[model samples]
Target: MTFTLVVPDLRFSRQAGFNPLTEMALPGLASLLGRADRNQLGGQSAEQWLRGHFKAESAGAAALSRLVDLPAAAAGHWLRADPVHLRADRDRALLFDAGLFDISAAEAEQLLSALNSLYAADGFEFVMATPQRWYVRLPQAPDFHTTPLSVVTGQDIHPHLPGGPTALQWHRFLNEVQMLLYGHAVNDAREQAGKPPVNSVWLWGEGPEPTGLAKPCRSVRADDAQVQGLALAAGLPFRALPPAFDASGADGELVLLDTLGRSARQGDLYAWRAELERLEAAWFQPLLAAWRAGSLPRVQMILPGDEATLAASLGPAERWKIWRRPARLEECLVMGS
Candidate 1:
């Protein structure tokens, strides 16, 4: 599994406030809400108590009022009960979970549909990489996206979140996936720290197949520095590329973003499977080489699929950097697999 991510700084953080509602979707709420200090209900009932608090908001409460739409209406009460610091603008938003899962193509399509409808009003640009992966351009920077130990999971999301399969379950599931993709050493770090997997949020981001890795591949085309910085922090080496463009007879500059793999949406597993194979083979060699050399250096590949899988290979401590630039794009064929 692999994906892409957009890394923003603090300026981006101020643009978007913390979205705690998504946090509630995770498994353990007691530690997050500081319920161990509260004398009311023991920490065990924190989830239920938190939900109740958000449900009791007065009609037309301040900025919080906007969050209540029948589904989230219940949360209003919780906000009223346990008032915490909140700001109008958010901090940062990242595009992730791209091509990092094993979801079927049809399932990916349904998930994307739900995300498009749910966040349509936000005016974020949606870039489709494959049927399952995508990138969202947000009006505000979301603070939650940059967490070191975050989990993003999406199944068919037409009905409601945290329904039968809770967000925490998805978080745990993704962590397991991360372990499978990155290696058990990644999970070991979290366990040693005595902290539950860190960044756990259940919701839809683009289609289910590509998940969140698609867009970062393009964004990395331009901003390799930030991506490289993240990779270095994760104790990985960053690989540099030559150029991505050609002067030969070409059909204009098919801006990589516009040429996203194929027309296949999340619903088309057939196309996704073929593309995935092509991508893995292209990227695995370099990554495997890096691993063998004991330098986990981030390598740039021409295929978005390669970038997605490479991203998935990173654990909470690992970061994959994608950059765009003629200098950054190179001919994978020249490597001579």
Candidate 2:
């Protein structure tokens, strides 16, 4: 049996401040990195890595995610029209994800209703399985692809917008949507309550629906929508991440840890550190102990980040390869000073 860990947002820049990981005890993480054969994962984010795993070349993540809650919501091309706030800087508007405002189901419904009611004639419908996860059933998919929201969160959003023949048209449509959201009672209440308003819907995750999928792992344990969706689409057993590894044994389990990624996307360093600590105690340490005891046959860890995603693997035989000594957590990560 083998265990694969897909942990994103562990990469951090060597910036000046209270480094959350500097003093943290991470013997398991360190040992695992030290003994494993290391390589660079090809994709930029966890979603890309998982996509390649399932050979889902044209599968839009939006559709896959929607299927988790509404398994029957398949059969059409779907887009992730996630709600976001575009914060205006001096020269550019920085994008922020939905978690910032803690939008309620009622608020999400109010906003989604207004957009659907206004754009129904244009063949656009807004639907939500969860308040934070929204989808758009378009009459047809757009011509171009879009960057994931996590890619540009807390950064300038204009440059990341879909570019091509439809760019200008989308811009206009978004502006109209913004106008509607601006006058909505939800935003009015949010503003009065001193919170960011739901300003725009980030339309992305466009492509073909998931097809030709095969089980990459025996079982799937992840907290990510795309991962869970892929597992379901492929007919693999799926479950949310447990607090710790199943002590009985692992059977080709693939775990995706994204709490760190979410905090990173939201620019919450404190939360990132806290999550790192939690995973260390719950996941990393336990996996390392199990692997060392030969309870597991193999261990593989993939850290998906910006340019170079870190990949490492180890087995009992690796313990004899003293030359490949364990590395410091900072050394294993691609950091900026």
Please write out the lDDT profile of model 1 over residues 1-337, one tens digit for every residue: 1222211110001114332122222111111111111111122111122112223212112122122112222221111110001112244223223333333445334444444565467553333333433334444422221211112112222222222324465455334433332333422454476632222223321111111111222211212222332222223333442132221211111111211123232334455445434433433333343333435333221222211211112322232222211111112111111
- Best by lDDT, which number? 2
Per-candidate RMSD, Å: 23.3, 2.1
How many Å off is the CA of 22 in candidate 1? 43
lDDT accuracy of residue 126 in candidate 1: 35
lDDT of 2 by residue, 144-262 (tens): 76888778788898889877778888888888988899899999999999999998988888876788897778889887787888998998988888877675637588888776766
TM-score of 2: 0.93
RMSD of 2: 2.1
Candidate 2: Cα lDDT at 284: 82
